[model samples]
Target: MPPETGLRIPQDNRFVLSNARVPTELVADPPPGATRDAEGALLLDLLVQNGRIAALFPAGMAPETACRVDLEGRHLWPAFIDMHTHLDCGHAIPRVRPDGTIHGGFSLTAEDWPRWTDEDLDLRMEFGIRCAHAHGVSALRSHVDSETLAYSQRHWRALDRLRAKWAGKVDLQGVTICAMEAWIGPEARALADLAADMGGILGGVTDTLDRGENGTYDALGQALDRLFALAGERELDVDLHVDQTEDLSAFTIPEIAKARLRSGFKGRVVLGHCVNLSLMPPEVIDRTLALAREADLAFVSMPTPMMYLMDRKPGRTPRWRGVTTANEIRAAGLPLAIGGDNCRDAWFAYGDHDMLDTLKQAIRVFQADEPLTGSLAMASRVPADLIGRPDLGRIGADLPANLVIFQARSLNVILARDQADRIVLKNGRQVTDPLPQHHELEAALGLLDTAS
Candidate 1:
């Protein structure tokens, strides 16, 4: 059947997606004798029903009674999963000053949190999630600040509401971001317990490591012990924000590995930032990567925000790049995923939950240009694995019908285009109007672009 001029998606979760140019590499465990053509494209049709992928058939072979939507030979892949983000805190307005440095960003966060009303929080979070969904992200793990007990609990309640609201459209996971001292206290424990009740992850920042980098790391190590203990007790995963600074010697990745080993943590351990880890000498970096691998630690790179925050000194140009050791970490065979950490927030202004934009920036910063360079996995495949959803982002029989159809033949074309044309589907139905904020969203995105 021919597609209509505008969105021709069916309201029911039953349809036949045809004329898709699926990549051979994205198909997981294809049937015997299945192969791609000379151009690495598999012209296939997907049969989706009851919110799941019923089967994969050859082009023009789907049942005639089912509603059909032609993909126009566009590339089809699994919808992206953003493994790390600060959704609850995403701001559409410019939060940081034009002359702001890293310290200024941090100060802005502390200053902004108290002023945010419940309605403002919900508005921003909803806008961010909607943007993510529109851009083909089906699942995302957002870190919410868990400072004071009351504040953290309120944010969790707000997220729960959003999660329930976006249930089938997007799977929203929350992580309680707390301070090191919180882990050792009752307030933090209550916060972690609440997070567990809400099916959220436990996380904290380890900035105290900067004070005792050369010493025994007694305080930070003890804090990790408490944090992991809470996680183990709550039966939740661990995600930490660590070493988000330009101090080259303030490395916490190694100590985190040691703490993981000491605690016998077998659950998923996700660490973000580690900017100082990027500034270390080659030998030290190798050693740290090895330790991290031994401890089974997965790294999340926030390139745009990290780049904006790192190595800023008044009246001086940045001498170092603000990126984690992506190449070295991948070389050590560790799981590495990249994320759009903050969106138009105080941390670093400007983002709209576009994973392709994130991937393009990462490709340039980390120089992962080819299939051999391991760039693709950082956004799609690796993030799915890190989020424990192996069934996502792969073409195969008997998977959820969540998928993305990019209007490009390959990644090169997709990245080169100024405006990306794409279709986002949940359960085989296209998302024509995902935003609830309406025109306010446009104004917000406009503000973000100007702020950037």
Candidate 2:
């Protein structure tokens, strides 16, 4: 165990955490005379009362308290939010992709769909949620596969049960994902109703594979229009997988923006992936970004899965990083959030649903640490706002004392290592449960023999 694990915190709900380092950006209003570290993080004392932040005091200025734990400058962060994930399909690694390509992964997942009974889904989904909670994520939004009504209902029921079970620990939200073309029929209305019933978001994919052959941009536009109309009717926010392909011609982001504007849909719209945007011509990229700005769309980039699946050819080292134009997206003054897209499933063979790991990879992949503080927001405040939960991602007075305390005191130290020894606290209490073991799922997932 790590040295920090040996430090005991007060079990009572009220206490003082002295000399804690918090990111300046995450602190709503710093107390006067607050001192900052080299990376612009504020050093302060945080008071917790009844599981919420009571107040913040400049280091060494806090009032006397019955219980005080001195962190001595250890970093503290608000619990993270992973706004884009696929928990319904998580941890089916036994159905690994054969060729290590996007299509191969899709095929394998489709073939394995029959194995997703309620028992199998509950076990795998709960396992992913536990991993995330242990790693200090307080909220997450998952895109459930909704190819058919039957499959949609089955998984939604499983998610509902898990949502209730994990309440107060992890705030769970679901979104329905299918091809945009599937939303052009009456089933679209049905799905929208189901999403609203569950307090979920409407989602679909607008990729080249989903679009019909021979430059069917017109049909794609109509499909998006119908999707937005359905979402508007139900007052549901829309999240779409857009242009996740290497083909430069596969630019569906512009169409989505146009559809959003044409439909006059006032609800929030989120566009995920858009890797082809990086491959587009400068003018095309500029035009698409302009449209996205007008539509006020949010972007979520899942670099881990995209890097693993995109631009892969047998025996050829991948040349380009399979990520969207992250810098450009942020520069456009649009919301950009990082997501843990897939975890140990057919779409991705590795992940533990850890947002810290996700943010670390994103910083390296996107060079997002220029300011460091802003990059951290991509995994926290940005996603929290996108999910319509502004109160969940920042450390402030009156907010729940959900946090991750890292032994690393500087930004460089935190990013250089995984911080696996970091401490997680929910509702002002340290989470002592170990991460759920993989062997626990062996019998449920039929991976006993395949276990390594």
Candidate 3:
């Protein structure tokens, strides 16, 4: 169990948080004499005034204030940003994929989609959003299944309601996830317009599912050209599920990059789950990354779900880690983020919408903790920037005092266990909301037995 600290704050929203261990890189314009510990963490006293960060002073140098909370060297970070998620299909546990493969998951989810009423979607999406909020997630982008216009409208409306309800708490953004071929016709333009009306991003999947039917790379390029043109016309950003397969032939990331360069689409392009890049040979990987750099492509890796769903075989040991080339993507100077892709859905059966947990999993999977100075930014600043919300990710003066403070003093201690006892401060006030009960969802989800 984690030790308890008295987390009370004053009524006037003026306080000093002393001895907080924050990542050095996250601190912007630090005061003179601000010092870092051995692990490149700044030990500082942060002053909060009128629900904003007034300044950061060196440890023990803060002026006497009306209220003071001693963190006792606990780790503090900006609230997390989950750049990729599937909230519309979230919490459909026990309706999961039969064979634990990508195709199986798709089929299973499609079979279950007919049962998704508006109320059902609202309950599940609200639950997911509340889970994310309780876990210190300040912003998230969810990919809604948009195989048909009717289905897409329903989900987008449901998301819009939740977006309004959770307006200040969780910054919610939605993306339409469809097949690449779906973007080739007049309906594609309609879908893009719908996304713009809903203030959402345009997105699709570029996998063997579409490539097999589209017949050739030329057709795929034509489809991508149309997709980018529609997005450019609507002034919407593009987020895609690209190359999420183990087959060496399933290399669509490069083509997508080429299409981006060819179309001259100036909007932001984010590619998710380029799992095949990990299996590609060095030359192919180099070429794909070069194209990505030239196209200004950003990436978000869904490590947990990819690890669970990729490279599975019956009665055989799994050989590969189903993740993308995270290190190389980061090395190429591209904006790479880590996302918690699915939760209790057909695609994956685990996850609590916790971005800290996602970051910890990413660190273990990608070996991202060696330097420890900037790794936390992947879940915070990087995704926040990708989502166009720069104010939510870093700790700086004049920013809102939205932060999560943990009992652990160092990153290693945080990685050793789930920091469930974290204190979430929004606008310099504590959020004491408890996690939603599983029983609340039991009736709607038929989860009575699963809850047991």
The global C-alpha lDDT for each of the candidates, from Candidate 1 onward, is 0.78, 0.87, 0.86
Candidate 3 or 2, higher lDDT: 2
Which of 2 and 3 is the better model by TM-score?
2
Off by over 4 Å in 2: 1-4, 95-98, 208-216
Higher-scoring candidate on lDDT, 1 or 3: 3
TM-score of each candidate structure, all chains considered together: 0.90, 0.96, 0.95
lDDT tens string, model 2, 1-452?
22355567788878999999999878877899989988889999999989899999999888895488999899999999999999988887754544567787678888888989999999999999999999999998999888988889988888899999999999999999997777886688888888889889899888744445765687788888888888888888999998888987677887788888889999999999999899888887778888899999999999999999888887899988999999889888889999999898777888899999989999999988876758888888899999999888998899898988998888899999889999988999888768888887876678888765
Range of the 10 consecutive residues with the lowest summed lDDT in candidate 1: 1-10
Question: Which of 1 and 3 is ahead in TM-score?
Answer: 3
Q: What TM-score does candidate 1 reach?
A: 0.90
Looking at model 3, the pairs that clash are none
lDDT of 3 by residue, 1-452 (tens): 22255665555778899989999767767778988887888899999998889989998899995478888899998888999999998887764534678887788889989978998899888989889988888888999889999999999999999999988788899999998878986688888888999999899988844444555587678888998999999888999998888877767887888899989999999999999899888888888899899999999998889988988988877898889998888888898899999888888888899998888888888887776655778898898889888888889899888899988888789999888889887788777788887677867677677553
| lDDT at 348, model 3 | 88
- Kindly list the per-residue Cα lDDT of model 1 for residues 386-450, writing each as its tens digit: 87888886767888888877767655677787334577777777777643553575464444454
Leading candidate by lDDT: 2
Off by over 4 Å in 1: 1-13, 37-42, 58-68, 92-100, 212-214, 434-452
lDDT-wise, the better of 1 and 2 is 2
Clashes of 3: 0
Deviation from native of the Cα of residue 291 in model 1, angstroms: 1.0
Residue pairs with colliding backbones in model 1 are 78-393
